[model samples]
Target: MLEPGLYEQTISRELKDELESEKDELVSELRKIDDAEAPKILAEYVAEVAESALARISESGKDSLENQIQLTNKMIGALDSPSDLVGDSHQLLYLVPKVMHQIRGKSERDTLRPETPMSQSSLFTGSRHEPSMGSELKKEIASADRIDMLVSFIKWPGLRIILPELREFSERGGKLRVITTSYIGATDVKAIDELSELPNAEVKVSYDTRGTRLHAKAYVFYRKTGFTTAYVGSSNLSNPAITSGLEWNVKVAQRELPDTMAKIRATFESYWESNDFEPYDKSQHDRFVEAVKRERGDKTPSDLVYFF
Candidate 1:
């Protein structure tokens, strides 16, 4: 009287439930192990599972002789170094599966995967193999929903290169926030003026030239896709720094280094909320210029006095 395929469906559900119970039991057992012993135990378990799988394959007699020989040779090569075997086994059993899951979908793969095959993190040293920081920054800006930049100073030459990208980003309704300082009169008023004029931009300047020593430089690109990126290092918004200088910047991916990215976002928010950097206003342009001139030891007309 039961409907066709209903019996098969019930069996499938039962099997799934049984497998889930077994998986939960295995996880519970794994959680009881001490951190120091976990690696060795996991490695041993992998070796045992691999040995059993190989034994089953050998007994099955289904694979071609050449294929079997090739697989055996690979296994022998993998076992040559016991220490390396343990490490490789861990990667194959744990890391590989997790990475595979993360990049299974096309969109997820493109967003979460590192641009370079070397690693999930990147070091931009202005080398031939590495992509230029300028290009990377533009790419981030183009795709970002919001951009945050904290630099010691901004130079017109560097800002000019990426200005078009920033303009397009703003036009597309992307929010931009910048934090810079008049620490050494290195920042150009022109750059600040142009940035503030952007449709969706906010600029903050630290006029406490003598006391405020904010020298950190970072650019954070926040994406709604959950794959945010942040560049942190010695590179300021300068032509040489982004284009050809030997500046060292570490590009961190939120998907790969969640803790580090979280810290970065938190720190930037703290700095943004702090009163040390005041919101830049067009009316205060003269004041900002004077501050920069004073820091640079350039005497303005106001500093000069006419004798009677």
Candidate 2:
């Protein structure tokens, strides 16, 4: 018999196929309506389809076969439409072909039925996206227009990619506010300086000896219509962590920007108030070390040093 997991996938696919068929009918009906109402109808239909499709995918991800097929088909179908026509189409487009290659040449009845679908193992198999919640988070981030990145530890690799983008935005006179911790790198400061060359760009850094870990990672992007925000769980910013060793991060986005923006701004303000701010100075490293030693009442104990 097919493994229980693969059997579930088969059922998921079938369910998805049903959903797609329904969505197709809705679209067809909308086209025959008054042209004046076409935009509204199309928007409603696309939103409905995305919501329904995403819900089905999430619900059946680990439990059904027909849903899986439907998901695959819908993803492939989205690739045929305009990029912005469908929400988060990038992940769907990539997922379709990759999942298809996995089951090519395999008989659905033999691979997913109550008995036949389980007996065969000769066909291809693989998962297109990395197995994590990252895919979901990535989609949310890509949907936003403006993002505020919070930085504490100057993770070089994360900065390498993210910093330049910020610099460019600042250079081009886009509104951006940066609040960074004292434990930053020279390279990072240099990058910030480059960004400062732009007018109206505000960058602030705090050197704190009394504060606890500002140990949160997140980005909030704002737009005229909405905002997207994400919080990551792992050290995705550093080289050793992101490249060589294990790391994890999550991104969450919502249509409501005001609330997310306010929350992030409040949190950053807490850090800013707790720490002392000074002009960017390369010579302050030793002063920071001294402050830390003072906070520790001598050289910080080995156990505490690990945290530092």
Predicted candidate 1 versus true structure: per-residue lDDT over 83-174, tens digit per residue: 33223222221123677777577664344333542225688888977788888887777667899999987989889989998999999899
Candidate 1 total steric clashes: 0
CA lDDT scores, all candidates in order:
0.76, 0.44
Using Cα atoms with residue i matched to residue i, what is each candidate's TM-score against the true structure? 0.62, 0.42
lDDT (Cα, 0-100) at 291 in candidate 1: 87
Per-residue lDDT of 127-197 in model 2, one digit per residue for the tens? 23342223322332333344555645443444555454555555554565555554422123444454345
Off by over 4 Å in 2: 1-128, 131-146, 183-199, 241-245, 256-262, 269-308
Candidate 2 yields a Cα-based lDDT of 0.44
The number of the candidate with the highest lDDT is 1
